[model samples]
Target: MEAKQFQLAEELRKSIRGIVKTDEPMAKHTTFGIGGPADLYIEPADTDDLAQIIVWLNERQIPWFVLGDGANVLVADKGIRGAVIHMGKPFRKVKIDGEKVIVGSAAKLDKVVSATVDAGLAGLESTAGIPGTIGGAIVMNAGTYRGQIGDVTEKVCVVTTDGVQLEMTPENLQFRYRWSVFQEDKNKIIVEAYLGLKPGNKEELVRTMEYIRHRRNMNLPTVGRSAGCMFKNPDGYSAGQLIDEAGLKGTSIGDAVVADKHANFILNIGKASATEVKELAERVRGTIKGKFDIDLEYEVRIIGDW
Candidate 1:
């Protein structure tokens, strides 16, 4: 399998007219700063290049994962055996048309919020401080108390399950709490999206964004190697509150620890491994379940051979 993966990487490097790296360190890409390496790392030049590469890879049955800004994932220490397509800076593009913002899927959600707010757009102010790329945000229906990204989505352009490119309407995408059609079919790759926003007073929008930013700074891990939240809010309960009540805050496993400031976050204080992070999260889950009989589902996506 290793030999075949190497051969596939060679072929991919030769055929795809894009950036390619073998044994690329996943730690460098992920926010957690903990991972081994990806067998093959690719950055397609554009949508045309991306479509062709996906079609080719699918035909060969070579496993692959599409990564956005690498904020919401924990890559395993053993690394990934197949390919990883990184959709980042090179692909991000945003433009405003009247009250609509047409953005590339790789554009950062927070950046989009700021840009739209600068243009006096109102709908995205609620999403001001969310991290990760727009593509990942759409896949997870990322949101806060204000609103979800799926709410303002006018259209989504993606490479479908069968490797066909299509522009789909928002209604076609059944979005629920922290879930979307993309999650149901892992093969779907978001390329771009159109958002419908409303005109607003620039000062008011700025104030709202600032408040959101400050709230995030106060609650989230502002400076640390961590993937924001470890678990999802189960129905009517907040996972952080549950964990704090369970008395698991400041719990540690190896170098990973449940943040004392925000119980939902697991921080890598210094040189933590993916195994430590997962273990600490599981311990928190077990403690919560033991006390409240509620299962804690992970919000952080775990990838690679575990």
Candidate 2:
């Protein structure tokens, strides 16, 4: 398998202008800092590079996963069998055109928010301190009570499995509460997006972002390694409040602990394994279900092999 993987990497190098690594550690890429090595980790240089790589992989029937900033993600301890396509620095281009901003999918959500806010753009102010890349944010429709990314999104550019680039409008995106068309359509890779914004006072935008940041910092665990929020809010109730109410805070399974600061965040206080985190999450879920009769859905995206 190692030999085949090496051969695959060499073959991929021949066609695409990107970085390719064998047995790349997933731990280094994710925010949680808990994961095994991926068999092949790839970083495409640009849109054309990405398209070429995708087409090559598709032709070879290679299983691949699109990885963003790895914020709300968990990979298995045994790692992944196929390629992990990471849209890194090269894909983080941001171009502002009057009321619309054209940005690459890999642009950091916070950085984009800051940039747009600095430019006196009002729409992205609500997204303030959200982690992960723009691609991941759009796919999950990430937002707070202020607003959602989908609300400002004019269109999204995605590359299909066949390497065909398509410009998708709001109707095609199907954005709604922590969900998007990309969640269901694994074959589509987000490349670029256009966001519509209104002109506003830069001072007001800065104040709004600062307030949001302060609020988030006050509620979330700032010191520990975590994949942000663990569970999606169940309808009308907040997941964190439910877990806290259930007296599950500070709960631990090995080094994986339910954060005291925010019950929704399962933190890696020490050298926590994926299995430990999974068990801890399950325990939290069971307790919540038994107590409230509400089945909390996972906001974290668990990937790779078990």
Candidate 3:
């Protein structure tokens, strides 16, 4: 490491009270099981640590990314620059107060769903089958055909270099199909969340969850090492349907393959490189456009050296 990089890592560790990993392998962090490494990987112990680290990174003008459960993200083989704040066990906390639930940024979406069901709370049932953290869910307005996180999200807690920004809702943060203000501003990081839900029968909610799970099992490629959903649905057409119609399902480049079950999902069949996956994704997009004449927009965030 260079003197400047070493100093930055030292300063980051000093500023935050948490685990700080120097030159950490990002392949282990992401769900795709790809990526090279991050110069500095941090996991803040609490909200205070999270706040302090953001401030420090900004002061040094060092680039940093807030990584949640690493779903819906594609990091390059050359890796990311500066630091990566990994939201993990240290920050994963969920507090339930009647119909209101306060969830930490690192809290898993599945766990939150199960908790709400156990508590006999409705509204969060729509998030059943979605992967990744609550912070990620809120940032991307994660949802299914039945409902979205925006429907129940009362307030979103965020942190930036300036300090902690509090209580943001769909009313303030434009929620659209798989998008929110968090994507527009990389500097603003989602930390905690407050969701207001309605009361419902536990048995009914469980049934709803089961039905959603069944749909997901039959449709999405959940068995392999892959990032969920490569492209966003274009208006009336589904991206998966377009790819399947193009007959590119089960197409392969190196070890990466377009899942036969879901064309929108690029699975790492075994030991696939980032370059191969990216190339296959680009090719899939090109083929779909050539056949349909409609451009497809990517939903997953592609970061780091390309």
Worst 10 residues of 2 by lDDT: 215-224
Residue 251, candidate 1: Cα error in Å is: 0.3
lDDT of 1 by residue, 1-306 (tens): 668767888888788788878889999998899888898899988887788888888888878999997888999999898889988665699999999899999999999999999999899888888889999999889998689998999899998646689988877778778888887778778999999999999999999999999988887876568988889899999999999999988899989999989999999998999999998898898898899999999999999989
After aligning candidate 2 to the native by TM-score, how far in Å is the CA of 226 from where it should be?
A: 0.6
Which residue runs of candidate 1 sit more than 4 Å off their true CA positions?
1-3
RMSD of every candidate to native, in Å, equals: 1.3, 0.8, 1.3
Model 3's alpha-carbon lDDT is: 0.86
lDDT by residue for model 3 (1-87), tens: 567777877766776789888778788988899998888888888777788888887877878988998898888998988889888
lDDT: worst 10-residue window of model 3: 160-169
Write down the TM-score for model 1: 0.97
Better structure of 1 and 2 per TM-score: 2
In order of TM-score, best first, we have 2, 1, 3
Give candidate 3 misplaced runs (Cα > 4 Å).
1-3
The segments of candidate 2 whose C-alpha lies over 4 angstroms from its true place after superposition are none
